[model samples]
Target: MDIFADFTQRINVAVQTVLTHYEAGDVDLSRVTVEPPRDESHGDLATNAAMVLAKPLGAKPRDLATRIAAKLARDPDVATAEVAGPGFINLRLHPGYWLKHLAGLLAEGSDYGRGAPTGRKVNVEYVSANPTGPMHVGHTRGAVVGDAIANLMAFSGDEVTKEYYINDAGEQVSVLARSVFLRYREALGEDIGEIPAGLYPGDYLVPVGQQLAERYGAALRGMDEAEWLPIVRDAAIDGMMAMIRDDLTKLGVNQDVFFSERTLHADNGGRIAEAIEDLRARGFVYQGTLPPPKGQLPEDWEDREQTLLRSTEVGDDVDRPLVKSDGRYTYFAADVAYFRDKYERGFNEMVYVLGADHGGYVKRLEAVARAVSQGAAHLDVVLCQLVKLFRDGEPVTMSKRAGNFVTLSDVVDEVGRDAVRFMMLFRKSDAPLDFDFKKVTEQSKDNPVFYVQYAHARCQSVFRQAEGAGLALPDFRALDAGALDALTDEGELALIRKLAAFPRLVQSAARAKEPHRVPFFLYDLAQGFHAQYNRGRDLTHLRFVNPDEASISLARLALVKGVATVIASGLALVGVDAPDEMR
Candidate 1:
């Protein structure tokens, strides 16, 4: 069903035949590659077998190209083979091949671009926001990117685990507990003045404070820090986690596993401490003094011996600390234990989606996974850049301290979930994105979300128009390949070529671990659909509902339906809804 693969196989056979006839010194068949020409006018597919083998064979590329072309000329799949611009074999496929592609699309439908399963287990950890506050715009980008990547991998036939790592045991959570306690005191009518500089001042936590007062009453009012810290910390953590889960649900992201950082060290059982000890047993951990950090040294910096990981051996910038001077495990230590747990669970591939600010930390983390797994597991970290919010061409300022930060709920409320998901994925994850409130909502071709969705809606409109003309639409199962040959228009062929490339596109994007390519491919596919639609405006005969000719109308309808099927399948992968009607 893959015309490109079919043609490549044909060319490889031809090349081997030519080599055998010439008795050319052993040619490496594995070196043969077939690809589409960068310039479309060149051909449907091109190969450089002749050019690649020419120098070693002591022959001119042009002469070798002629021999290869003559051998390939006999292939039924190849309509014509000619050498163009310095020994490039330009190949034009038979019209029947393209027609077969349309039929294949109809046959496969939603499963057309699915790939063979690798059967390897992969764990993708993303949107592991600290359970201290509601998710903001920054976390939203990571959520969408991570979720789309997991979806893409799953579609590509890999077993994927979607996970969220909760930082509930960290110092940040302690700060959150104190902040909530201040809110609790405020709820009890205590005059806690001028919300301290580093404490959370958002009104969202007021409810958490009030709920604590209602539950505990005056029992916690006169208790020392030790007596009430745990009580308040647990409540605040639970409240924050609930708020975060709600924000994720609003954006259509649901985690398969919620991993608690505290669980690694629960019951003073010290599983994390045990993990570090195991690493030390493997020579990955040792007591060492680190070199002073470059650029700027902290005013309180002091030279001291601390437990460090042998990260430099695995390619980190420098050895990393595993314990702070206060004799507590560093954040990196907890991360190592968490990844070890992932390995124990039988995942050989792990992907971490982090904010752009964590770019400097990528090498050391990858090194840790490498050392801990002893090169058995592969870890890839995708750093998503910050999103700058704009409204009417001006920057949107958000300050959590000033209680002015825009929550994820606010954005979802302003624009529906479909627009939010599509726009977030319209750009590469590593590239800084500008989210314009006014522009995305506008109904215009300039808005890519609307444009792609409109293509889907237009396809449905064609079906409705065909019904109005009193013509029965062709069943995809009943469509004849020969009848599709009537769609010989240049634009129609161009769209079909794009459709034929979908499986290859999916494989390439999945192999590269880049889900952004899906949106880019969708945009190009939408452009093809739009161009074909606009073509009908000029030539009424090309329109889908030509009442005078049922046969021609049915063929065109089949083509548009193919376009709609692809749009729906692609949008579904990225978690965007494909609408049948756009108002």
Candidate 2:
């Protein structure tokens, strides 16, 4: 049961009673919002109903809060309601209410914070890195964010599909083919000079060349470019995809669907053309010459009329080109067709995770999806900022030419998947992150991953200590309502209240499409657990493992276990492991 919801209902009923007495004509009740105050001393919950309606009704906010509090007092759930600090009503729930909520958490187990399903199918497409190279740190952030969002949505009752859009057919892949072919020639004992300026210089591709030579031998030595490009391109794309898949696996990410860009116009089928025609029929496509870009233009920039999408009509900064002047479909065109295909497949809601460099592309992509779907489909694009690597306060420079770039596999190898996932999600996706290798691996309270995991381990430690002391733990079936009352300490009650807020947190985070909130909530809850544990260190009487009484110990153990369960559940949603042992 959501105590916040229950309390909100009580307050709403109280406000209605006051409204009936005052006869305030036609006040908007929808404006009333009950929320936990920023400062805990303000109360369990504070509402702005009185302040919001005061000016409309020609009544003072304080007077309204006084009347509302009196009406709220009739409810047994509310022990006391008082107005404090700038017309805010602070509510103190009865102690029994929190204790009973703790029981519900233990009974619910891992399902404690799960919410009802929204029944909307959401397609979360992320880490759609080009299939020409291995994923790097930037791609890892997107992977973690998308994966966490999928997990959070599923937990909150939404149908979520984790997808990866593979850009397997593009000019970049063609470049990859040429690069691999060079490697293949090198494997055939040819003395190729220094790797060209535009070609890939990573040693990772050297093996791809060797493998191709091993498979085809010298038969492809004199083959024409057209004859060998396809064979080499397919091999290179497959090999790169394999490496990317392995890197993602190391980071604990697996895509449910790997959509290929090549499929958009493969064989005789032309979905891209069809999508363009559909838009053209809707008057969204036209032949237009784009004004020269505001900033510096390349010397090769040529002013030409090209087919464009009227994206500005929907909210884009400028109408975007659908086809380049060279008479080839632009990347934007392919993206529009891909989104159309997604909508046709019955996913009305879509999320795209992109790097910060693609910030300018967001508005146009959203506009295209809006126009093509006729506003039926909604698109949310989350842009992840850059991650600066630091080791002992020194910046770690990664150069592509020097072949010194840190791959995703490199980070995973240094610090296990758990540390990488947790650290990546410990901040807002839009904010720049500083990843310190030494700091993340450290086992201390400063390390958020360790701090949260330590709370879980400590809970298990309490259970072990109690069991070793020959204490008879109460049977789950036999524990009565009164047994829970033994947990009467203020800190213990506060921890229970925090646990009770889990479902609401999940609901809000899911609705906002902000999965970073989960890690923040876990950190707050861990702080509570740590505070209570540290308090026991000073007050031996508050300890969970009391030698004097077994019943009290059993009740306290159950409470600790409840904390552990919620922590584990929250960690699972973020794909972070909850360890029973910290080491």
Candidate 3:
């Protein structure tokens, strides 16, 4: 249970009672929050109820705080409700309260941190890297962030769909098809010579070319460019997508939907055309000439009339063009159709996980969401910053198979999936990340993933040690408040306090669309567990497995189980494993 949330309600009641006693008018209590004291020495939980409500009620904060603390002090659960500073209420719960909650934590087990279900359907579209090649290192962070966000939302009780947008209808795939054709000729005993400047030079496509040669033989080569382009394009897109899916699987990202852009342009651009007509009907579409872009010279700007969206009416800085001068739909038009399709599919909340370079697309996409949903839906875009790889402080070299950039598989294969995922989320998505090869592989506390995983391994080792010592293990399911009667140490209570904060953390992280917070929480939790373990090493009374003293050992074992359960659950949300033993 979230003790902070429970106290938040109690604090609300205390504030209401004080207001009624004073006959003060109804005040907004929404701003009042109950959280742990930044410094644990202050108290267990702290609230700013009096400070938030004092000014509106025309009273001194400290005076109001005394009244609220008096009311809260009457509750049995609150051992002390002291007025701190100007108006904050610092609460310290009775030891009995934590013992009861520890029993509850053991009972809840894996479900301890799960949130109440909200009937909201969310669509998280991410890692929609073009299907022209394998996923590069540039795409790895977004993929990991997006996947973890989806997992986090699901764990927090929102029905989420993980999606990938395939840019198959774009010109890049056509270039891919041509590139593969060159390799196919090379596979068929032709000297294709050096790869042309505009074509992809990656040897990763060689297998696709060889497969095409094996499947179609000389049939494709005899046809005209138009006739063979579609066939080769289909084969190449299929091959590249297969490779992309494999790489995502290696990184543990399982997308539920792979929406193709080709679907948006099928039937003479029917979906895009329909989306434009819908906007026109809503009076958001217009015919106009955009002024020369701010950074572009007048002569470089096109002066022709064009079909455009009145995106500025929503929130975009400038109007967006829907149809280019060539009478074809622009990429932005495809994005519009895609948004419309998702909106039609009953998704009220859409999240886009794009690269940091796509910051310019944020306002336009929000404008599209506002216009297409008619202000009924919510849209969020999370832009992930670049990741620079290193090897012992030196910049890593590129992959020969990928021609220039490093592939996702390269990083995963070197450091393993858990290290890649945990490190990717170790920092905020918008902040730059520097990933080093050697450091992540180390097993010390300097490696956050290892530190966290080792905590779990240590917990298991405690139980194994008990078994080896012939001490009967406590039944976790049968544990209750009475079973924890011997846990009076301040250190033990502090650990319980940290475990009690998990539900609140999950709710806050999911609401904010920030999965990085999970790893941060796990790291701190591990540190606490490690510190407690070291304390046990110094003081025999705090040890978890005592062959002679069965009561305290069982109590400490229960605490160990609680730690392991939470660490495992948090790791699952982060898409990492909580191993029982570390190699």
Which predicted model would earn the best TM-score?
A: 3
Model 3 has an lDDT value of: 0.93
Q: Mind giving the per-residue lDDT tens digits that candidate 1 earns over 1-583? A: 5565666677777777767656776766666677889998888988887888777667788888898899888877678999987787988888787888898898788998887789879999999998878888888899999999998888888999999999888678888989999989888989988879887888888999999999988678799988998999999999999999999999999899999999997866387788889999999899978889888986534488888899999989888888867687777888889999999999999999999999988998899888889999999999999998999899987855328677788888899888888888888999999999999999998888888899999999989988998988767856768778778888898898898888777767766778888888888999999888887899897776799988888888889888998899989988899898998
TM-score of each: 0.94, 0.95, 0.98
Assess each prediction's global lDDT (C-alpha) against the native: 0.86, 0.86, 0.93
Off by over 4 Å in 1: 21-32, 50-65, 85-87, 267-269, 298-302, 399-404
> What TM-score does prediction 1 earn?
0.94
Instruction: Report the error of model 3 at residue 431, Å.
Output: 0.8
Candidates ranked, most accurate by lDDT first: 3, 1, 2
Q: What global local distance difference test value does model 1 have? A: 0.86
Strongest candidate by lDDT:
3
Q: Give the range where candidate 1 is weakest over 10 consecutive residues by summed lDDT.
A: 397-406
Please give the clash total of every predicted structure, in order.
0, 1, 0
Question: Can you tell me which runs of candidate 3 are displaced by over 4 Å?
Answer: 24-26, 297-301
